[model samples]
Target: MTSTALPRPPIKGSRTQPIVAGLVTSLVGYTSSFAVVLTGLKAVGASDAQAASGLFALTIAMAICAVGLAWFTKRPITIAWSTPGAALLAGAAAVNFGWSEAVGAFIMTGVLIAATGAIPWLGRLLAAIPVSLAQAMLAGVLLQLCLAPFVALSTIPVYVAPVIVVWLIFLRLSPRWAVPAAMAAALGIAGFAMGQAGTTFLVGELLPTLHVTAPVFSLEAFMAITLPLFVVTMASQNVPGVAVLASFGYKTPWRASMISTGIGSSVAALFGGHAINLAAISAALAAGHEAGEDRSRRWIAAVSSGIFYILLGLASTAITALASASPTGLLEAAAGLALLGTLGAAASSALSDPTSRMSSLVAFLIAGSGLSFAGIGGAFWALLAGLAVRFVIERKRH
Candidate 1:
């Protein structure tokens, strides 16, 4: 008799469950992040394709780690394009260097992140930070993205405002179907209006294009991008990402999460991606929802995301088409609306206690100010400002 044993089937549920959940959540989180990253690239004078390439690098790397880890763990441990990393990238690009320099820095940051992940001490240090403070920082980091749709409404009133209203209504009435329904509605309205206006929106007919740049070593770029990326990514993305996994009752090693993210980031950096990190908020959704009562089924979701992301990286033209095919108003509104819960939770925790109130406010303002220095971004400044306030307060008390 043959002695080989086939792997057990995943707990009862469709294998596609996690995949759909991962894609949906990723779409919600990445759209705003992509907008910011692409805008930053433009600010630094990168061409459209290069900017898109950056996004492509990030998503593909994340897909690999997220999918691979999930498959190994038999759990739905989803990773994503690091929003905090993207924010850091925008600042680094604007101040310290151009796309080339940013790429150099990205590789360096990935190394540091990997090292941090490999070292248990750093992981403990990260966890030692007060949970409330972590939540506050997470809130601060997400605030800008959460507000973008409303901000867009001021300029693109007809296009964005209606979608926001309908999304809000759906959010109240049917939370489960809210996102997809709002998305469908937005597209339908936009299509009808465009048709009446005698315009058509269609994906372009173009073959996939690939361009890979070898890494360049730039000390200046490395100095500027490294610390800020390390700080923001750990504080804003990894902290929350780990927290989400914990909240969902998975006890994956912090070292493992960090290592995966670090490796993913490094791999992507080699290909000109910005940075990669563990996802926090959206990950919770994928891990918690109907994908599987058993965590293993969720692994399938992450693997699917990885596959989709590979397609995205290789088929840049197709990726853009998929993103562009959606109505602008719909994408904007849906992203903002989806983040409502996470945003509220962040604000509540940040403002909850009187003891750390001042420090939290400092953190909030600096992060929200959108400041940049020597190619680093605001999240670093905010944390520094908050730590400064905390130190001062403690010093005065002593």
Candidate 2:
């Protein structure tokens, strides 16, 4: 059983802090990375309608998961869409197939995630994978996306510069709010440009809608999307999320959390979402002392955060429209800035293991190279090449 901090009894008026903490958690989590999520969906073949649907689907699914799992496990087990996996998707080499195949890959990824929880050996196998290599793959995937802000400076300095300025200012003053501040500034730019262009949002587009597609399985997509997506989400989000909660004295109900997120991911894939998993970077807001000193009451914060995300889902279309209206590099700069920290962390960890350094470097190089073979993408090749190098290095030692 998971160790949700046991409480003496319910205290009057103690709920207020956790409820507000939940609100802050959802607001920060959603604002910080929605651009990356939308960009990734589009990169993988989602049309505007489908991408909005995917955003809505992810928000709602994870919200449901956050509420359900928190109630079931009575821990601050917040759920979030896999932002790093979305970055991987954003950096993915273009595929020959379309959205339906991407959806199929999402389904397979969900199955693999659930299998990791349900089947004992699968989780062990994932644990056996070297951490340096996994992080190297992630760092490689982030390289191009992280470079977007600098690239924008050369081409569209007029539009992207202010957003970066806002981010830098906040990075010094309040690092937690840096990306969201940049996003708000980017949206402001989009709104101002819309006025200059004399363009008005359609009343209908302000509301969200679901656009479901029948999934189509393909071997190339499985190789290109599914494996990489699964590995990245597990390595980056779910595993670290558990660790974060553990640091705060909560033992996440592992099997239940995995099953809940995996099922949520599968359901969301039909509506065009790529994937959702345990909240990684954003989990602390709800679980931390800011929520309450009464640790047992912190699950209240997670549940309320889920409710807030469901409300946020209502604006998926509006946000998508606003972002699509923005000057291209402006929105991209926001996404890139949001990922910069993660890139630094992953790169640092990837290089930390001295013996594994060569293999990690190989993975990082190959993944960033954008090489493709027979329709499969660079990410798959990067992992394979890194593993092969690691094997040879170990054999030599023997």
Model 2: residue 217 alpha-carbon error in angstroms: 0.5
Candidate closest to the true structure, highest TM-score: 2
My TM-score estimates for the predictions, one after another, are 0.75, 0.96
Candidate 2 at residue 347, lDDT? 95
List the global CA lDDT of all models.
Answer: 0.64, 0.90
**What is the per-residue lDDT of model 1 for residues 1-398, given as tens digits with 9 covering 90 to 100?**
67998998766556667767766666554543454454444444456566566667777777778777887787777787765555444433336556666667677887878888787686677655554555565566567666767887776677677777777787799765565555555556655665666764344433344346566667666655665567667766777777788887877656777777887787776556667777776677677865656664666766666676666456454434334445554444545555556668767888898788888887777666667775565666676677788788844764
TM-score of 2: 0.96
* Candidate 2, superposed: residue stretches over 4 Å from native: 1-13
**Alpha carbon lDDT of residue 117, candidate 1?**
70
lDDT of 2 by residue, 49-157 (tens): 8999999999999999999999977899899999999999988746677889999999999988988889989999999788888889999989999999999999989
